[model samples]
Target: MPVDQETTARDGDTPDDLGSVQYAQTAVVPMDPAHLERHRVVAHQKAHPASWAFDVLRTQVLQKMDESGWRTLAVTSPSVESGKTVVAINLAISIAQQTNRTALLVDFDLRRPSVARSLGLNRPKSLNDFLDGHASLAEALVNPGIERFVVLPTNRPVNSASELLSSAKVGKLIKDLRERYSDRIVIFDLPPVLAADDVMSVLPRIDCVLMVVGSGVSTQTEVEEAMNRLSKANMLGVILNKDESPTQNAYY
Candidate 1:
């Protein structure tokens, strides 16, 4: 797979006649095979039945986003353990795998960032460092060994996560990522809507939102409250995850 580098002008740097800027670039890092298998990151494992579900999800999600001219998607749930992160990761991988689109998965759940762990990536420099002014956006991106797929993982929890998400830096970051590439789909694995205010703080910056509800986990009241909170945001749809119904698969 070819890596596309987007450059920017530095201090005192001049742009070319074509208006192209010169800057440092980042490359993809290979992921561990064993680690991926251990964590059930099966989207890349095309032979797995679970991978098909994500492919279906990817088709629907991309269609909606394209119809609305939306590029950034935030995946959240009513509460913790609702498998939002899993859905986010798998959806991204499936999109990248099935289409020419580039899928960028961002771990924006600063309170309990798990995208890296779930993808079996080590403590690579991530969004925590980027937001703290210790790393650049390119430095924070990891390829996770998937073609046309990248990830901005958060290695640890941050204090005042809601405030951080609401900060100007975060807003700029979101804008930059969204506008960086027209063909790229940036998916944010945000914290549960009811677990913290972080989701609400960042929801406005995202193009659309997707709620993941685990079967038998989220209560009716909890779902209603989540819907109320997201009423103002452009909600793409709700995903019913971990379904055990004999008639349907695990995910819907």
Candidate 2:
């Protein structure tokens, strides 16, 4: 994969920019006071009667993961713009609000990362950067005004995003996060499974793969095809987005 060089600006560097770099890195950024309001808004946007379904879904996921001893999780869909990022982010936020538990949101969608942007944080160094050795984990993680919750945003789109995600370094990164944040939840916002093999490559590393299917859009055939490509089936589940049926709510 082609790599870019990291650049740090002078004292008067632009507030909106974080210099130029080849690959993104994971860093520990202090939480800003303003992040609290942003967190509330994010939480509020996710808070709905439909959200109760996710609360139930979360319990089910935890039950399955607990039985299998899985920690890391990958949230994805079959196509782009399927609300996977929003589901993953909201789920992570809800998990973080569990009193003493922590939650870490890892934006693994190098193709189009927007987790940090949505949370009002600067674009961050990504898993690709950390795995490629362009930056350290401590340099990429940020606090978006929530206690015990952190985000690792993908800073730039790299040509070899797929290869980087499938690399051993990415595996090691997941392991390290689980260890360091043993008290926290690690949620990975992955690229769409059908968009690339990135989601499939990282599935085995996670405890479960939550597949978000757009209601009235995703066909059963497409979902079956994607499921067939997966190595494990027990860690898989379907999340229907924007369904009209009472049994098929948005959270499920």
All models: lDDT? 0.80, 0.64
Query: Where is model 1 more than 4 Å wrong at Cα?
Result: 1-24, 243-252
Question: What TM-score, over all chains together, does every model reach?
Answer: 0.88, 0.75
For model 2, residues 1-252, the per-residue Cα lDDT tens digits are 111111233355454323222122223344443663443224423544545555566677776766776678888887776667767876776676653666788998988887776666664455556566786554565655555666778877766778877777777667656654345568899888788877767777777778888775767887777777764645457787774322243443
In candidate 2, which residue ranges exceed 4 Å CA deviation?
A: 1-41, 44-53, 123-128, 231-233, 243-252
Task: For residue 1, give model 2's deviation from the true position in Å.
Answer: 34
User: Which prediction has the highest TM-score against the true structure?
Assistant: 1
* Candidate 2 local lDDT, residue 174: 77
lDDT of 2 at 30: 42
Q: After superposition, how far is residue 233 of candidate 2 from its true place, in Å?
A: 4.4
Clashes of each: 0, 13
On the 0 to 100 scale, the lDDT of residue 100 in model 1 is 87
lDDT of 1: 0.80
Candidate 1 lDDT over 120-160, as tens digits, reads 77755888987887876667777766778888899989979
